[model samples]
Target: MLLYCFTSARTGEVHESTARRASAREKTAKESDEDLEARVMAACYKVYKEDVPLFFFNIFTFFLPLASADYAFRDYSSAHKILDAAEAYNIDPLENNILEVIHFEDSIRDVPLFRPLSELQVTKSTGRSRGADVFRKEFASLGHRSGYTRNVTIRSCRRWALMQVDKNYSKTARMKFASYVSRDTHSKHYAHPLSEVEGLANYLGIESRNDHIQNRRGMGMHHNP
Candidate 1:
């Protein structure tokens, strides 16, 4: 609507308050725009059956690259019922598109169904997933379970703090903070390979937004829905 305000403005000048609130609203809208993809990526991770960090993991992980055009999420939302239509009070994603969502059933079962963003509240979880140990092991166990040299690589994440934050903490009481950063970084890096998830999408006959990128060139602009 903010974009439209300028396009439909009278002599291209809107009230100052309108301009201010519109800019804020645009930012808020952009934030809400991310909801669908975040869930889709979370769903991708869920299929992995591996544990992950809470909160930020749902919105971002190396698993789902939020690198697509803004319109891509809308495309998924339209077909897969990614957003609850009743509460979202939004238009249909497939209103004029050639592709219809075929991945989800009329009643979705595997993927989680979420309420509209307006009705949701964010909160921090006090506990990590039961699979966290498994996730950590996957990282440290990448090469070995630890045998001198292997121990160094696994402990390298912690040794990193000694040269960095540990020195400062040595003069204070903040060593734990450095440990937290290293643990979180390991989990964030390979939230399970992106290609693996995309491959799953292809196997399931779900048309992914990434497909648009590859096809857009060979088939021209309107080639994808």
Candidate 2:
């Protein structure tokens, strides 16, 4: 994604290796904080004007982890807001739901920028506890936004999956596929079985080898590999 950003910023004329080397060279020259900030803001503004949907999706993905955590904690209000926004735009939110490909350019003709982040409160205390408290509050707000995006994605995926099975499968097959997709999305994406289900298993004294195996896989471990 970083490479994509870099290439886009440069208009894709430069080769990847050339771009990397150029970036490395530029890094050697110490940049003042103000200069760096100016460059970053300029690049962001350019992207915002040139490709608004990419900007929106980038922001959505940035908060996605926090959104997933919020959903896992049982919050649904944020997710509802995101779904409402997508519905208003008639967006499906699938991975391949590009505006050009899906012919949604007309739908988002007047789309607005995302809401600004909440202002951070000024704190007088320099103590660790005060810092931690502020950090926790800021993180909670971010998590709320993130949960919204995750829910939107999950709902979109669910709808798309259902449509896919309906068009291509027999009645019985459609039913089976719908049931499996729902359970999979609920367990893997929203509920997160490793955290929620494993804890439940521990409480019920039903923890098993399968749970351990899943935990390992979730951590990016693979027995075959």
Candidate 3:
């Protein structure tokens, strides 16, 4: 049931139908543009379920404004909804984008949403500083900030911070960050066995396996001599 609600909200099929009906009514009436718009907005609200997913709510709140200048100019309600939804969901991207639009649009900045930006900024800064302090403690515990371990620790901390800020952050990016950090630290500090090297070389389509053995012997001889 929740999935169905999410799908309906995400696709805006229901809203589209409501809009079409509103248009039909508009054609029959001599209503002004503002009245027609208000009626449509009211119709859209009537279909909203109480348990609408935060994701859909967040998208619905600000997407219209970003997508259409005319909507942004006339839709203070959407702007207000975005402010409430963003705060409720702790969605930084939504908050940031809407704040940016309000900042530059000038025409709508005086609305109630604009007044909250300063408070939001302070709250975000405080949260970031708290995260930084926690990171510092964790990083300090790793000790000796100039080594491979330090680099890995830093990357891990950064990944954690990204997760905190955005729940929808890419899983592939997280995997890549982890994979690269692990591979780098292992390659730099741990020597692979000869069999492992030969297997890896074979996998990579490098020349005959004997080359690596011969190179190792050559390096050993050079060091000894």
Candidate 4:
């Protein structure tokens, strides 16, 4: 068997490339499972709860039926029975689940805009040792608002990951990110969009230790590529 190898041009690390490809494949597979579960749970939620066509299966699945004061979806056996009943009743699970889908979509759209780093006070309140932990808490707060739905895509979810590298991580992190993404223009998400960087700098209460405002905004710029 010939093992395929991919080499990263930046790092010249062949192993890292293979590991990344493997990780992507794993993530794709996991997403497929989530999609299926979302569909099935949506259908089950509809029958057990209301006739709402757009069904949103909460990330905390147990809460979906509880919202309707219905417990039919709670038991594994009962859930399977509901699926059979829906099929027997000739219910088009997808069409019948429209209301649920709509609500679910709405929840997805509520993902928070990136928080201003200056306004964040996770360290004072929680006594969390690391910035990553602080960011995780912030992300969790966002998740809770989305009803703990796992299907949502969030831009700021990884902000905590960046905070992990340095507790005092601020615009410097964005600059480093921009440089990293600039090297490979394909990864726009990894870097702060120009607007986000600007919005962050403008948030009222956030203190700026960096003397020059323009420097913070233009940290990644180089005279030449």
Candidate 5:
């Protein structure tokens, strides 16, 4: 017997090109009920989950489902039954579930803009520690949001990660963020798009608001990436 090997350039893995086909053929000859069933289930998922016409099943599932079908195409009703049984899940429910646990504060103050670093009294304010903890927790939680779903989280994580620990280190963002914290004349200050997540008092879900001075009209998420 000649063994055929094919190397896939994308993944850089050597594949035993004939192994599956040969095993499937051997299985066809012996016809073990359990092995055939597993193959049948796999084929069923591929066909149902993907939008493909029945005639095109051969091209899609590597002809594996067709082989496992055991006259599945011939028996049209049985094929329909298999296809209809495939499972799919909606992520809206997952997002809703996440929203349920998240809390938001409507009256939260943004950091003061351009406040001299000398003015901050982190030791006197309990809110400062609490807010920082929320940002940190938001960064630590969740499997990543695909795009901008966690835009707030993304910005918070970025700022927190990029910040220098040394007190005197002057990053452009630090004072602007301080201004945001003070919530003083936030109307006059311009914030980076990523820092926009800090507007909420404390929250995970998104909120819609209109600030005529800075954004005039806009929507933003309330938390970290």
Candidate 6:
């Protein structure tokens, strides 16, 4: 209506007197609808379920009280429903993206659904500090991380940590490696393996060939996340 008024005025098709009357009536018509307007205001509540955030919805709906008295009815019930739904189901979406240290805790508690800590093959380190021993003591009786001797060609443990954190392997590759290592480590799946350990070593410039190196490396070998 504003545009029509402007266009009409510019073209001189409507007299100023006529434009004034039309604008007044248009403004009155806009303000006159109470029920239809209120329903429209109520309908805005649907934004809660859409991409909009709950806080935004709350602020927008707060002005519902400022609407014409008839249009001021608030939808607190709908708002509460939306807030409840978000709280109930809103897992930190980023949790799925990153492997967190806490995930190991969950994996431990859930058992069988996720890989146990013992499944990740870690090379034995030197010394009797027992870092590897501690890592193994609390889990399934699988892979051995013992003191290394001259004959054992143990890989770097850091590489294993890197693979745990950053590497992405094909499902087929993972299953095949898991099967092969499990046979040696005595498990069905291998969580930490040669590639992972190798990757970590390369990144950290730590050569963990035996428990001597691993002992020096200590808990630093496992990826933090």
TM-score to true structure, per model = 0.21, 0.20, 0.17, 0.20, 0.14, 0.15
**Collision count for each candidate, in order:** 0, 2, 0, 11, 18, 14
Q: What TM-score would candidate 4 get against the native?
A: 0.20
Between candidates 3 and 5, the one scoring higher on TM-score is 3
lDDT string, candidate 2, 121-221, tens digits = 11221111112223334444554565532212223334444544544667567556444434344334333333323555677798443557445534422
Decide which is better by TM-score, 1 or 3.
Answer: 1
User: Which tens-of-lDDT digit does each residue in 1-225 have in candidate 6?
Assistant: 121211111111111122133334454665543412211221121222322332433433442232212122133334344345556765754423422111112112211111123432212211112122232233222222333222111123323432333346554554454323232331223243233244666778997455454454444334222
Looking at model 1, residue 66 earns an lDDT score of: 25
Winning model by lDDT: 3
Report the error of model 5 at residue 67, Å: 58
Q: For model 4, how big is the CA root-mean-square deviation?
A: 21.8
| 1-225: candidate 3 lDDT, tens digit per residue | 122222312111221123344444546587655544322322222243324333454534543444233233333445556556457856555432433222123332222221112332322321111122333354455444433333233333333333332234455553353333353443343233333246666788986566666466324212111
Off by over 4 Å in 1: 1-130, 145-149, 152-155, 168-170, 173-176, 179-225
Looking at model 5, report the run of 10 residues with the lowest lDDT sum: 1-10
lDDT on C-alpha atoms for all candidate structures? 0.30, 0.35, 0.35, 0.33, 0.30, 0.29
Best model number under TM-score: 1
Assess the local accuracy of residue 99 in candidate 3 as a C-alpha lDDT between 0 and 100: 31
Model 6 residue 152 lDDT?
A: 17
Runs in model 3 lying further than 4 Å from the true structure: 1-80, 83-100, 104-128, 138-154, 157-225
| TM-score of model 5 vs. true structure | 0.14
